[model samples]
Target chain A: MPRILRIAGAQMGPNQRADSRPAILARMIALLDQAAEAGAKLVVFPELPFTTFFPRWLIEDQAELDSYFERAMPNPDVQPLFDRAREKGIGFYTGYAELTPEGKRFNSAITVGPDGAILGKYRKVHLPGSVEPRAGDRFQQLEKRYFEYGDLGFPAFRGPAAWHAPVLGMLVCNDRRWPEAWRCYGLQAMELMLIGYNSAAYDPNGGSTENEAIRTFHSTLAAQANAYMNATWAVSVAKAGNEDGSGLIGGSVIVDPNGVIAAEAKTLGDEVIVADADLDLCRQGQTKMFNFAAHRRPEQYRRIVDQVGAQPPGA
Target chain B: MPRILRIAGAQMGPNQRADSRPAILARMIALLDQAAEAGAKLVVFPELPFTTFFPRWLIEDQAELDSYFERAMPNPDVQPLFDRAREKGIGFYTGYAELTPEGKRFNSAITVGPDGAILGKYRKVHLPGSVEPRAGDRFQQLEKRYFEYGDLGFPAFRGPAAWHAPVLGMLVCNDRRWPEAWRCYGLQAMELMLIGYNSAAYDPNGGSTENEAIRTFHSTLAAQANAYMNATWAVSVAKAGNEDGSGLIGGSVIVDPNGVIAAEAKTLGDEVIVADADLDLCRQGQTKMFNFAAHRRPEQYRRIVDQVGAQPPGA
Candidate 1:
């Protein structure tokens, strides 16, 4: 039998300002149910599942900003999701604005096992957007202002056997664009990477988004690129469409180790897509082609870590 | 003036079984002339441009195998093409099998300036195919039996100003499939990566050629992925079509920093594609978003070097 795992990506539309946390969770659970019907034991949801893209606005009031964060993972409001998942024996991964008891904030993603136990958590290491507000942009990308850089580096996990015991890892939004993010997980030998992104179809500051197609193209390109290069499955979910007049692109997709788009969401709204990811395919990448252990010239790649970032040498 | 360099990719069909070294050089020169007509200052040609991909067969006689290699870069047979290029003030990159004076064999690629000066040379670091003969399949790939691992690592160079003086690097065939190849250039802060690949349309060993589309999709995906991730231009040329009964895939393409296929060749045969590479656009990648120097989490990626290849943790 093929080591196949039916995985689902819950592509979401934008969360409205009036969206209650309960309404969002209900939608998430409905997708989970849909995934189960499609024979998926694991489902992945879009980033910041509970609220509108909070980073789009600059909130001065502390409470208003904190409102976007999930103070605790299994709080009263989200308990239903865990219970429903446990009942179905389904595993899941979700991205949310995280607030610590001491008031520290992070863009975090958590992986939960089939038994409803938290398997592993990953904070967005490659934080994108801006730390400061730029009035010229259609929407402010103030992730830097709102959340501290994630200190918890990329980590991988071997989840419950029900989900095919996938050696999995997670990333949030902008983290997907950085090659290093995928390499870290690849180095950890992650078979499947669950990624949730809240990408603005239009980044006014970049100016390239004048044709929104560029934004979507780039978004999917990152997904396809990492999947092929790392020889791993990447399920990228997007919270797309207009949220309070701010448009975002939606091209949620499942990429095979060969970087082929096995299945993709067509609409910019709430949608669920499922596909059989033959984990055995990764074995080809591991043992035959991209077997990193045998071929990587790590001794030469030392500069990847020693340097702060790529500098145009002698520029 | 836009900091743009009009670059061309000379995508060639397979060197016919009857092709002589002189005949191949003539065809290469014709492509350069065509590129110059398109206002190109630089052109890239596919790997093993002089002869049919020889690794597809096993050779028992040493001198018989050595016949496929160029004893020196400017041997009389190739000097005419270099002279023609210098006359037209066009810089070019080409991949070929190189046999050193000391009889060292390597899958090599070299970059030359408009003035016909050798700018840089790269031996294919990630040689694909097998060393030992496997009788289970139709063709044999004995790259290990033929070439030594490259001692000279990936390096970047700034050539003549006519070619935009963009920090450039080169890789041959199998190296493009490896993410580390691109990352090495990215870490060196290269602005353009010139690559040449002669990939078989079907691998008899991997019994899935029923979907020949998968290999094509993967070839292009690898090109686009590295282009976007490294925030650099990648001009990938292919030697395709049937050579002595073995078929190769040809999808020579020019990918921008945005991972967009700025230009591509449609035919699985000899073709040329050129595009205006806005070197300044790399600034957007360098300064705005993919500023690798600022964002890469290298410290966490130490394992990429510590191990031989990626092994799932606890494997």
Candidate 2:
């Protein structure tokens, strides 16, 4: 299919806990307008765009915790975002904390068509952060404590492009860091992959003394590397800047199949990085240099298939 | 066992067609001397270090074709390298064309202990280039026509260091570009990964018009990405510089578990990139951030095991 998808990675500034959902969605709409003005057919927003990375903090009160979850995607706060996308005839990918009617909390990202209909949804499969709260830690990265592991596997959807729609898939935050997470979309032969991340400068490992820039470097590196390896166009957006005193690394990026960063956002504020990505160009790498069909030796690799050695020494 | 091996990636310039095995071995010896002098316990060399990139040309004569493969590892010409390494109490990794007594041919790399004993061997699995020569091309890459697919799947070696030896695995040339190739080593939880390559500046896909620097970028990108994702130390050495009439890209690099380039070769000629890698640091990414044992999702990933969607739309 002949496809040229002009896409944008909309990096959002920090969302303070005091900021209402309307305030965040209004900023998303502004970014959407900028992306549309830049001739972007689709724009991808950061993970939990409506919240200030709520999982970074540990809350004891149940009422305060429930306040972080989105009861429905198009609740009054987000309907305007859908309205703006429809008006501009632009598709978008956005992430948020989803709480089901039964009160099951899951980290989710969804793709919306230009007509404001949901195309597909993916949960954050490779969730980061420990469940136990470390006393001395700068931030409580108790993601596992706040939300459950995403039940949804990486799923691809037919896109909202004008014609010759590109295949699309969704990944969130830490999922972008794992090569295994991107492999599923690669297997589906996805043309464009969207990932939303909330990367903090806080090093849970106590390894990095460098500023938030370390996460920015790693975030862009993984995005470009996965795109090049899989022969797919990947867009990574982030909730960057300091939020509630926690500093975040904000380097949202768009990478082509050659591992080249085509367009990248420089600032730690509301920004839109746009580039016209010819999905057709992704074919050369696939057909010539990296023909997975001809080159991949799946049968020989029993380790990944069997999960052999994917265990600790005594376990 | 406490273990730390000071290693070097001994990058070499291409061997001209007129160059003798003695000439190539002499250069390798010089590089090894520099490595040993620099306190390196192990050194790694490029694929087919003793010969020019022979697959770039097509030879119809059987005698002329057979001349490219080495009859034995420690045969007269390369024995000097072994003798020097043993004398210096240093181990090394080197790649070469192997011809079995039964007339089998394979592109292989072997790990040698300080005592000049073969610790382990691996044959190149992901053979690149094509059998049918594409005429009017700058350089022909018909490796599939010359060498057989490596029989040895990426194997792990347990020795070549002091007590508490680190696990080692080998990859040759084009094999470094494939994620599938690196996964096997990562699955084995290899402490250190060795790769030797002969990368030509020529582009086969007719896509890149840029110089050899592009290949250098790709080589380093893949190396760092694989190491970071798998939490292993990866060293890539190359046969660089203009060889014969064709130019090769050289940027030998060593990347740590954090996907940071610890050391890199500056020139396209014979150069040694040395680094002292602390083996223990690799554990944090494995045990904390990456934690493959705790984080890998094998159950949902049926495509890899069943090879589903691996093939193109049709056979």
On TM-score, the candidate that comes out on top is: 1
lDDT of 2 by residue, B200-294 (tens): 77664464544576667888999998888888898999899888788788989999987899999999889999998888768877777677766
Where does candidate 2 clash, by residue pair? none
For residue A65, give model 1's deviation from the true position in Å: 2.2
Displacement of the residue B198 alpha carbon in candidate 1, Å:
0.9
DockQ values for all predictions? 0.66, 0.47
Native-to-model Cα distance after best TM-score fit, residue A217 in candidate 2, in Å: 1.3
Off by over 4 Å in 1: A135-138, A204-210, B136-138, B204-206, B209-211
Instruction: Name the lDDT value of residue A89 in candidate 1.
Output: 83
Give the per-residue lDDT of model 1 (tens digit) for B135-214: 87668888887998888877777866666678998999888887777888887778899999988887645666334577
Tens digit per residue, CA lDDT, model 1, A37-100: 8888888998888789888888899889878889999788789999999899888899988999
lDDT of 1: 0.84
Model 2 chain A: worst 10 consecutive residues (lDDT sum): A306-315
Q: Which candidate's lDDT is highest?
A: 1
